[model samples]
Target: MTPLAGIKVLDLTRVLAGPYCTALLADLGADVIKLEPPRGDDYRHIGPFQQGESALFTLNNRGKKSISLNLKSPEGLALAQEIAAGCDVVVENFRPGVAEKIGLGADVLRKAKPGLIYCSVSGFGQTGPFRDLPAYDLVVQAMSGLMAATGEAGGAPLKTGESVADLVGGLFGSWAIMAALVQKARTGQGATLDVAMYDALYSMLTTSHALHFYADKTPERVGNRHPLSTPFGCFETADGQVVIAVLTPAQFARLSTLIGQPGLPDETRFATDEARTENEPELRSLIEDWSKGLNTEAAMVALAEAQLPSAPIWGIAQASDSAHARARGLVQMLPHGVLGQAPVVPQPVQFDGVKLMTYSPAPGLGADAAEILQAFCSVDAARFEDLKKAGVVA
Candidate 1:
């Protein structure tokens, strides 16, 4: 059987964070019923369109059922409560108190079914002074010390090219949900998980933490270079930049030989890792002197032959379209409404005896309302039509 095959999730979430968490579950074979608002997810409007369809929504919301309901209506809210009570888990990304205000809070639903796992993904968590403040991915990245630790040394702070804060928050939220499931299986008790974007992003700074706590120093952005090691970052080449990591003495010796600096490692200033790092500028210039004479491919070939670790820098397209990606099935096609077959990145880990499981594309707005209603609420055909007519389910 597929992992999580029988597990059901009531995904009352929109946008990136919550959708991403449920998407992972959907890939793992959960029957994720995505509950959207009347208009639809905000991602459906935001673009970078794929044939006039939102790629953001397509990528993040794969393998789930979609239903639209107006929570303001009493009938719709009751329907949602019914669905939540039936599902094993309820995930939401709303700001802290909104779920409670809408009458679908963890306390309310879990009161009806104590074995329900409820997860809330937010900016700063459900409590604390910053709980009430609004949050955005960029804002969380800036405040989480990530931006301060990013960018060129002595330069302005910069957010990552991707939304690491939102993504990490979703990742932690998913992890917490699965852990809660395990706990529920053991003790027959559920959990209320609070995942904060700010805390999630902040907790990922291990290097920064090490520096601050052990070294009594604030981490300075060293651009595309390692702070503690030499030749452990992007280096210049004839065609483009390449990444080279010489972590051990053996790798350093091989790297030195490849770059025609075999005798340099014997020098006093380059004898130790710290010494080599202290004289990084000189060593970097020496390495580049040899690297700039050759193309990236040639340099990589020579480094590989010398048993040195190196890689050519690649962008999203190059990395995604790589042969390795195809072989590993990191990218696959899922059926879509407009795009026919859309590329999706499924969950990377695979369980034993599990082949490549085919998944459905993200649903059209309210596409699964009738099916989900019948399954979860056991609503009859007449009642389903009546709810639609009343603007409860659309």
Candidate 2:
């Protein structure tokens, strides 16, 4: 049996961070019930649509059921409370106080259920100086100092190519939720998890942040170079650029021999890591002078033979199609109701000999409203019809 087969999750989150967190839970075999507004989640309108449906939304929201309700209405709020009282987990990404305004806040739900695992994912957090401010992935990236540490030296600060802040927030949130679940099993108590996008991103900037904390010096962008380790950056080769990271003295010595600069490491300027770092420009140029004549594959072979860490930069397509990725079953092709076959990244954890597979398609707006209300609430067909007529459920 799947680890989380018996657990049920009430997912009230929309967009990236929160949805991604719930997606992980769903992958672990939780019975996830996505509660949407009458119009559906805002991500449905995001680009890269297929057959008038959002592929982006499908990627993060598969393997869950959807039930639409208008929380503004008293009946709708009551229905949601009933679902929360029965579910093991509730995840929401509304701005601070929004859930409280809708009468579904952690305190209220915890009082009702007593053993509910409620996780709140927001831009800043539930209680903080920036709690109420509106934030996006780019805003969090810039505020967390990640932008300042990225990109070329003296160039405009660049946000990462992907939505790292959002993705990390989701990953951390899921991890925290799982830990809380384990704790609940042992303590017979529930947990209230608060995940903030900016906080998560800032926590991940440890190396650069450490320099400022201990040395009182902020790290500047050096573009693909290690902030502390010498000879740990991209080098130009005949075919393309290859990255090499020779961090230790032994590795440096081996690298020196491999690059035909045997006595260079013993030289005063490049003898130790500190010395090499102090003379990075000259050292890098000397390495590049040798690499510029060798092709990327040949350079990689030489570096590998010398026991150095080096690899060619790969684009998304190349990485996705790589032999290692294929062997590990990192990606899977699943049936998307409207998008035909969709490629989805599987959950990172593998249990026993089984990998989690997609069990259901992304729901159409309110697709399971009637079924859910009937099964969980024991609401008869007549009552469901009445609620729909009253504009409570769509």
Candidate 3:
């Protein structure tokens, strides 16, 4: 049996962060019922669609059932509260106070079922000064100082290539849910989780934030180089780029010998890590001068011979098809009935010598609405039809 076999999650989230959190729970064998509106989740219309289905949506929302409900209607709100009371977890990413206005807030649900774990994912959390402000990944990235610290020195600040803030919020939400579940098991009570994208992104800036405390200065973008360590960044090769990190003195000495600079360890300017960092420009130039003569493969080989940690810069295609990633089953193909084969990112967990396989396709809009109503609410065919006529269940 999977770890969360008996858990039930009512997923009222859309887009990325909240869906991602519930997706993790679904992967662990929780019964995740995604609640969407009549038009379906907004992500359904997102790009990378195949055969009129959104591949990006499917990639994150696989292995779950979808049911459509219009919460604006009184009947719809009542139905949502019913599901909330029955489920072990309810996750939402709506703006602050939205759930409360809809009558499905934590206080209301907890009164109905005190053991319900309600996780609210937002841009700046529910109680912060910026709580009610609308936010997206780039906005949070900029607000949290992440964008300021990224990219090349003296270049325009850049957001990360991916929606790291949203992704990290999802990861944090999942972790918080799991921790709450553990606590519920002990105390027979539930907990409310407030996860903010800005907070999550800010929390990830561990070492970069630390520099301010240590040196009384906020960190500046230093391109690929490490702020504290020397010889710890990407170097340009003849054909491409290779990143290498030399942490300790032993590694530095080994690197010096490998690069045909045997006396580099004895040079005052390059002798110690502090000295090398103080002279980073010269250190980077010295490494690049040697790397300029070699291609990426040759540079990697030389670094490996010296027991240094180095790797070629790989694009998504190359990394996805790489031997290491393939061996670890980081990518998998799932059969999506109409889409034929859909590629999905596997959950990053292995348990009991087994990793769970993706078992369901992304649900067609409201495909399981009738079935869910029947199974969970004990609603008969007549009642379901009545609710549909009343413009509640879509």
Candidate models: Cα lDDT each = 0.90, 0.89, 0.89
Residue range with the least summed lDDT across 10 consecutive positions in model 2: 353-362
Off by over 4 Å in 2: none
Model 3 scores a C-alpha lDDT of: 0.89
Return the candidate ranking by lDDT, descending. 1, 2, 3
Where does candidate 1 clash, by residue pair? Answer: none
What lDDT tens digits, residue by residue, belong to model 3 across residues 1-394? 5888889999999999888888888888989999999998899999977889897799889888999999999878888888877899999999999989889889999889988899999999999689988999989999998888888988888888999999999999999999999999999989988999999999989877788777787878888888788989999999989999998999998988877788898999998998998899988888888999999999999999888999999899999999988888888887887888888886887887677755787788888889888877888999999988988988
Which portions of model 3 show Cα errors greater than 4 Å?
Answer: none
Root-mean-square deviation of each candidate, in angstroms?
Answer: 1.3, 1.4, 1.2
Which scores better on lDDT, 1 or 3?
Answer: 1
Tell me how candidate 2 scores on lDDT: 0.89
After superposition, the stretches of candidate 1 with alpha carbons farther than 4 Å from their true spots are 353-358
Q: Distance from true position, residue 372, model 1, in Å?
A: 0.8
Highest lDDT model number: 1
Against the hidden reference, what TM-scores do the models get? 0.97, 0.97, 0.97
